[model samples]
Target: MTEQRFSRRRLIAVSGAALAVPAVARAQDVPAAAPLHRRNTMSFVPQNWQDHFDGLGIAAIVADTTSRALHFWSGDGETYKVYPTSVPRTDELTKRGYTEIVRKRVGPDWTPTPNMLKEDPTLEYMPPGPGNPLGTHAMYLSWPAYLIHGTHDTRKIGRQSSSGCIGLYNHMVEELFAMAPVGTQVRII
Candidate 1:
């Protein structure tokens, strides 16, 4: 057998490639492992407004807890957007069905729900600021204490981390808050 030699650079490249092969193969094992966007949106499902709404009255929003995605459509059907969201932490905390946006607030204060307070008496009222959980904007739902809002904790996005609200990235919520009017129809599923 003839002796073969490898440069130091060549050895490292070969070793690195060899180490990466298994990781790449493991990633491909799940054929459905794909990202819908730049974020951690692995389970996003493309939704049609027609399936959930009777009509796009002014604007419509559908928050899909199962997919951890929020879908929005404008009244004229000209604007459509999808956003990954943080859903309620448990099915028990989830309130499904239809509701309308009753109000909008910028720099919203966060008051823990009665149940939330009961569970954690340490929780105190929070005024809107950098430390507030409601991020920068909020759109209240017809249902009491329910909102489509933004979270300061970005990790909460793309995960089931909310008490009952649907959460978006602060930037996304700011955008949605601008596009969605107070009367926007909302559905949670």
Candidate 2:
């Protein structure tokens, strides 16, 4: 065989192009108005997530901050659901721990947290409605000052754009609220 050599910069460029091809292809395959639930968007799921799910005998909620996705594994362990989610924008604000659902509400109100108000004093509490940031449902977590809630801004889903909470699409949150009762274990990774 003949000896061959490749430049480092050429290898990096070729590798980047190879990685981008799949993302471009996936984007083209998805319809413009299609909901994320109907799309194949689990590219960010951890390789060993299924192994953890297999060991769980109880229902659980798992959030991967890096992936910006939430997984609901049923008690049966054989069934699971994934939802596109928006997580805290900064690593400092993203928390990882074991907690449980403390409460659940429908058409939840939006009261700006103390930190939020400090950022913008003009912000006011919002009543439950379409315009509310907490769109249709909210699940309070055992951890203080944290929650998993629906968002009115659908464009933010699958992104890192929240203050310190997990945000889901309205319909997906509604479905999740129905399936996840109070006291469900929530593990953030």
Candidate 3:
């Protein structure tokens, strides 16, 4: 285990329910006494540790889709990378039949249907076969069948092809594997 400065507060709030939008935390420079005003339909709430972990920490996520680019953000927005693959949402995964996802290191989950995924520190890949999709590295989110991992099918990279998991190139996933910790927040845009 590594030392992490994560907030127990956010963990507590999430324990109550999985789907609620966890509060977005604000910067320390902002005053707690002063309330932030919203100018649009989307009201701005204070971002929590998780929010800070996103744009300003070791976390990463698939921010969006492009015709060809599979995007990811890591290292306080300093590391930007893209791969070729389609990411599946909980709804889509549920449609396919999986409803529970468990991030091994993270308890419970946030998706409507849980999809269990886990990192094999032992370098375990599913199906126990050659060229398995799990690749050399992985970030196994809760969806039992899904994961953020490398791809042997390089041609499928940058396309919406996976059932509900995020795909990356072999080298890219390996790099990401080295950077993200077990607790790093992964926001699939």
Q: Choose 1 or 3, whichever is better by lDDT.
A: 1
Local lDDT at 120 for model 3: 23
For candidate 2, lDDT tens digit of each residue in 1-189? Answer: 997789999899999999999999999988879876755543467533454444554568898887788988766667678888989888888888888799999988888889888878999989999889888999999988789999999988888888789999999999999888787788888
Candidate 2 Cα outliers beyond 4 Å, as residue runs: 1-42, 47-58
What's the distance in Å from true for residue 139, model 3?
Answer: 0.9
On TM-score, the stronger of 2 and 3 is 2
lDDT tens digits, residues 161-189, model 3?
66566767777777766666665555444
Ranking by lDDT: 1, 2, 3
lDDT of 2 at 97: 81
Each prediction's whole-model lDDT (CA)? 0.93, 0.84, 0.50
Which has the greatest TM-score? 1
TM-score of each: 0.84, 0.73, 0.46
Q: Over the stretch 25-80, how does candidate 1's per-residue lDDT look in tens digits? A: 98776567554344545478889999999899999999999899999999999999
Clashes of each: 0, 0, 30
lDDT (Cα) of model 3: 0.50
After superposition, the stretches of candidate 1 with alpha carbons farther than 4 Å from their true spots are 1-17, 20-41
Candidate 3 TM-score, true structure as reference = 0.46
